[model samples]
Target: MGTMAFGRSGASTAGWTRRRARFAGTAHWLLVPALAFTLALVVFPFGYTFWLSLNDYQFGHAARFNFGENYAALLHDAVFWQGLGTTFFLYFLSLALQLVLGTYVGLLLNRRLHGQTVARTILMSPFMMPSVVIGMMWLVILDPSLGAANYILSLLGLPPSQWLASPGLVVPVIALIDTWQWTPFVALIVVGGLQALPIEPFEAAFIDGATRWQAFRYVTLPMLRPTLLTAAILRSVDLLRFFDIIYITTQGGPGNASTTLNIYAYRRGFEFFDIGYASAIMIALMALVAIVVLALMRLRRSL
Candidate 1:
């Protein structure tokens, strides 16, 4: 009777194991659709762009494989280098301004205040507007003559100066424009981070007689590194690929002062029809954005 019971138990365990294995195998099929979508949209486009980068193709002409000549030419292209420098300049400037202003605004919003809901909605209005609309709106407002910005300058008894028309000021002006539109986004992220943070550390700091700034700098800031880095990573990607507003306002002018890699690529591909070279420029920009995001991720991990 004991030997028969043991044989029956073994058979039951083996049957259950087989059933579990079959269920696991079936579960994997659920991922197939998502994988197919990613392959079709992301992988294919990237592979095709890379292939185009290696060729010397122009619009309305046959593609000629040139063994990386497009990239090689990019190495010696002065405009490309200049555009890269401008791109970084705008990227860093815009990012710094946005982070600082956004974090400050976020801190303000985190506190209990009257009319906080109304203020947040008003502040976020710019971010909700379409980029093209913002561009067109600013273009009108920043017009050197007969624009509100200059009119306000005149009201202050200060001489009105060119805002976007001046080459020296265009990049910084654009940076400020972007900061105006996007800082609220960073602030929103920061507010979320602040609300999620554990309160114990802040309480301890206060009990230890730490001032508000000290508490923020030493306690709050350290805890918020990951959140801040997340904001940085998101902003860095957008800033690097900045094109729409600049294109609408300056079109890579006043004389390439505000030209970024994205603008340059657009001109090359759409205007000049240098399809292959433009693809290479885009590939380079992608690499640049990837490197910065990865570095930020590493820093976040270290913190």
Candidate 2:
């Protein structure tokens, strides 16, 4: 009877082990569909784009493998260089304005003020608007002659200026417009960061007799690095790839003064039908965005 009982216990243990193994195998199989979807939707398109960039593929012509030639041409392309410069210029300018104004707005919003909720809701309106609609609206508002902006300038006894038509002012105007639209987004992020911060740090600073400005500069700013870095990374990606508003408003006009890499790539691929070269340009832009994002991520980690 004892030997029979021991044998039964060993058999039961073996059965349980087998069942656990089967369950684990089933769990792994459940992940296969998700993996397959990712490969099909994400990985495949990127691979195809990279492959296309290495060829001479035009819309109406036969594709020929001309690896490196497209990228090589970009080296000597004046328009490409100009677009790159314009892209960075607008990116930095917009980012700076957004961060400064956003931080200031965020600090104000953090305070317990009357109608604070109403103020935040009103401020977020621009960011919530569709980019194309904002572009069109601004286009009408910034018209040199008939626009409200010029009308306001005339009311102030200032000379009405060409807002978007002039090449020199177009990029800056677009940057300011973008700042106006997106500053609230950055401010929202900042407000969240401020709320999440520990109260102990501020309390300690005050106890140490630190002035308001000093405490903010030394304590609040240091603690806010990660939050600011997060905001910077988000904005950097959008600014680098900015397209919709620019395409709608300026169309990279006034002799390509506002042309960014996105606009340049669009013109090459759709308008000129240089699909391979356009692919190369897009790849370059992707690489640039990746580099900047990666750098920001590294800084975030350090913080």
Candidate 3:
């Protein structure tokens, strides 16, 4: 009886050990599925795109793996370079105007004045509209011959200028559209940030005989920096990949005046069906965007 009991006890102990090991093994197996999912979805696709950038892949015929040739070709491609420059130009111009205008509007709305709520609602409505719809709406309003803008200018006895028809005017007009649509978004962010600020500095400045401008310059501006930088960084990232409004309105055209890097890549891939070249351009653009974001983040941290 004692021997039999010892054998049963030993068997039970071994069974418990085996159960714990199985549980740990199951957990390890569970991790495999998650890792596989990430590799299949994100890592694999990214790797493939990088590989395509090294080849001369087209829609048909034998694709050649021409290492670094596409990147070299981009250097000689005047249209591509022009588009890149135009993109940067538009980005900087719109960013500056939007920051200034949006901040001012935010300040105004934050004031304890009559009809402030109504005004805010009206201003923010534009931002809620779809980009394509905004583009179409602006097309009518900016129509040179018969639109409201031209009609008003005509009433003032000025010549009816071709707003978007001229290549020189196209990008500026697009910037205007962007500003109108996005300024309210910036303003809303600023207004929220302003409301959250401590009032002590502002009150102290006022007590020390600081005029409104002086108080703003000394107290308000310093306090607003972080929020402003945050808004600017977010806007910059969005503007770098800007596509919808440009696509809907200009189609990167009237002879490539408003063409930006995004539009250029689209043309290369879809219009021309040069996948490898387009992939190279896209990788380059992504790198540029990543660098800009990193710089912006560093600057924010320093501030």
Candidate 4:
């Protein structure tokens, strides 16, 4: 009986080892297609962009290797620098507003109440709308002459203000449009986080006489930290390449007040037909986004 038992245990261990080995081999086989796709689509284009950045490549001409001229020209260009600053400003402003408003709405939606499904659907509708449509809608709403915003201001005895036409207000208006579109995404992520949290700690806190705010502060916020960071990082990445709404709304107009890094690059490439210079700008923008992503990933790891 003892000999039979020993033989059975040894066979079981050997079978487990074989299963793990086969799983590893299958995983490697599965990775081949993904790696090939990355090399073909992502890495190849990335390397090509970098190479173009170092050349004065033009249509119908052999690419002239202009090593560092594009980078140097970008340095002395005040407009480029201003656009870069505006890009960062807009990125953060949208991120900040989305986080604040999204958190509020997420908390409200997490409650057990009637019509929650309908309310969530209604709130998320804006995010599903096309960017061009949203921009056009806002244009009419904020039009200085015939917009509802100014009309409301007039009703409140306030002077009608140019929301999008004025340089000072253009970026903020763009930020508002972005917030309206993306807040629901953040709220949805937060709601998922809230739902996934363990209820025992919250129940214990309540039983121990903790107030609602205190329970949230000590129990809920701590649990939601990782989710919030994840949402912020994702939003930041999207905002870094914010071009759709900006392009549709302002076209970086009214004297470059709304011009961001993406707009600047588009103007350089398509408008002026400086393909090499635009590629250089794009590579730089990619670097900036990579840095942000790396930083956020590190923060996520620490959390």
- Tens digits of lDDT, candidate 3, 1-303: 898899998898899889889989998998998999999998898788888888999977567999789999999999989988888888898898899999999999999999988999999999899998998888888888768989998889998888878899888888889999999999998999899999999888998999999998988888999899999999998888789988987789888998888899989989999999998888888877888889988988998
TM-score of each: 0.94, 0.92, 0.86, 0.91
Q: After superposition, how far is residue 276 of candidate 4 from its true place, in Å?
A: 0.7
lDDT of 1 by residue, 77-117 (tens): 99999999999999999999999999999999999999999
The 10-residue segment of model 1 with minimum total lDDT is 23-32
Clashing pairs in 4: none
Winner of 2 and 4 under lDDT:
2
TM-score of 1: 0.94
**Residue 265 displacement (Å), model 4:** 0.6
Candidate 3 ranges beyond 4 A from true positions: 1-42
- Judge candidate 4 at residue 150 and give its lDDT: 95
How many clashes (backbone N, Cα, C below 3 Å) per candidate? Answer: 0, 0, 0, 0
Query: Residue 231 error for model 2, in Å?
Result: 0.9
lDDT of each: 0.95, 0.94, 0.89, 0.92
Candidate number with greatest lDDT? 1
